[model samples]
Target: MLDFTNDSSGGEPSSQAVKQDAISDQALLDAYSNAVIDVTERVGPAVVRVETGSKTPGARERGGLGSGIVISPDGLVLTNNHVVGSSRQIRLRDNEGIVTEARVLGVDPDTDLALLRADGARELRYASLGNSKSLRRGQLVVAIGNPLGFESTVTAGVVSALGRSIRSVSGRTIEDVIQTDAALNPGNSGGALVSSAAEVIGINTAIISGAQGICFAVASNTAQFVLSEIIRHGYVRRAYIGVSGQTAPIPRRHAVAAGVDNKMGALLAQIEPDGPAARAGLLPGDVAIRLDGVDIHGVDDLIRALDRDRIDRTLEMEVLRMGRLRTIDIHPIERKPSARQGSAP
Candidate 1:
């Protein structure tokens, strides 16, 4: 105590100030720990281990494992389609080692999502899906999954990015993906990516091999759409106007001639033989400017225009061919399960 109170004379903080700072730092750390613990306690029960066995004649013994999240009290579980592969029946095990069998209700390979119902499960604990569209970069997130066969593993990180597109195993582009830094491993697929409020914001999907802190999840909004479609129709229905194209810049003159203000459009590189677009006289080298009065600024826009509602419905397509605007009426058809050769827009 010789002159401890005079420590501030040299511009150094006094002992009391140092003590207060230490306390504040500890408080922040405690808050972070509490958040993770609280989320785990609230949502961990809904996380389950999904195990699938190969139905191959000689590979019946081969099996795979991943994670899943219970979304309905009556036992609807959501997981990645790749996790379950082509298996129609699988086993689920929760954190408490309760094992149950679940049957695949529906699967959408394009979005890498699958829905399952536990046999006779009722009043089960489940988690609520949150609006992933509201997530912001740098926001804290907690991942609860069974990583590498470790049941109920927990990892904490931040939302690194959003609106990302990733290719699924089925060779389809999954749009509006959520990128996060939360650690993920093989068995983590199909688990829940939760917010601080314990809402499931995403379904853990992929991780860049050999990369640290880089992971991706399917956004909850996409999952919700897939869920509803699967529940109502038994499969995801998408309109298909067979055309292969890419986004290309529109010529200023062509833009003016088309009476549209889009700077870019989908350049039709190929028209599927006898397909809807070809049947409607749409040819290669034509740039699509609008569909059903919706501006087709790019290939994505064109894809979005051909929604489920557009299937089997006559729609007007505006295009610029040889600098001249042309309107073509085409009826889109429902895309087939085996038809994954080209884009259907």
Candidate 2:
């Protein structure tokens, strides 16, 4: 991937002499346009038009249209959870006009990402996940999708913003979202938000109905995390230590001792008896300093680190208690679905 930046001089073209091998200003413009076309060709094969239908009798037979990206040559695909919600009968068509049945591997509403396995995949073209954290504002980006059922449609634009938060259809807050003015349409959901060099950086997810050029994609980083868990466990998992806490600042000495940035931590207000933290010698008034190797700046940080992969694992932790730093080992358990309402995780 190019990892492009919109750092060119604004207003006028550069005055520096163009080298023999260098592309001129006019040629640069043509090259830019051609590069986008090339990217569309390179990544389009991996972009699949997804059609999901409801199996409920007496209901609408035809489902809606969406897009998806082939993430593995063995036929694993990624798309928005809403696109495949409660619908196991999924059909995918690639650029070669090959339509095939797909099986739902998993669906995670919290991140609005779902995984599918296409049937009879041989030499399937797939897109490589890029580092969404490396994306810069105004960098050149292209989206390949079947917008409005127009298969393999291509649109080019710059990234509008990064680290945005959008609400998922399941009413969960999707963090670290990618905002782009790439002109996504109704069938563009779950399409590939590709970089200049054709790396898949994000999966197109949503658009503001009344707004033009404002679209959102689930960041590739988040998709990677969700896909890994879904592939391994058939569902997204979260960990909790059975404690009530809130974000709080840490004492200067304790912060220095724990090597935590921002001098902040999660201050525990209550500890359930025989809970992981309580059994690990954590007191109700203690402030968690870190989990594993991740520094805890707040309760959110602690929660983010306690993902599905963290369950059943004994993680080293640091806490500030009684004006002293202490080390603790906690084995976080899975947070139950019933306890998810306004509860700490």
**Candidate 1 per-residue C-alpha lDDT over 21-53 given as tens digits, one digit per residue, 9 for 90 to 100:** 999999999999999999999999999999998
Residue 336 in model 2: shift from native, Å? 5.9
| lDDT for each candidate structure | 0.90, 0.84
What lDDT is obtained when candidate 2 is compared to the true structure?
A: 0.84
Clashing pairs in 1: none
Candidate 1 — which residues are off by over 4 angstroms? 1-10, 54-60, 170-172, 248-264, 336-343
Candidate 2 deviant stretches above 4 angstroms:
1-25, 54-60, 241-302, 308-331, 336-344
Relative to the true structure, candidate 2 reaches a TM of 0.69
TM-score of every prediction relative to native:
0.87, 0.69
Clash pairs, model 2 backbone: none
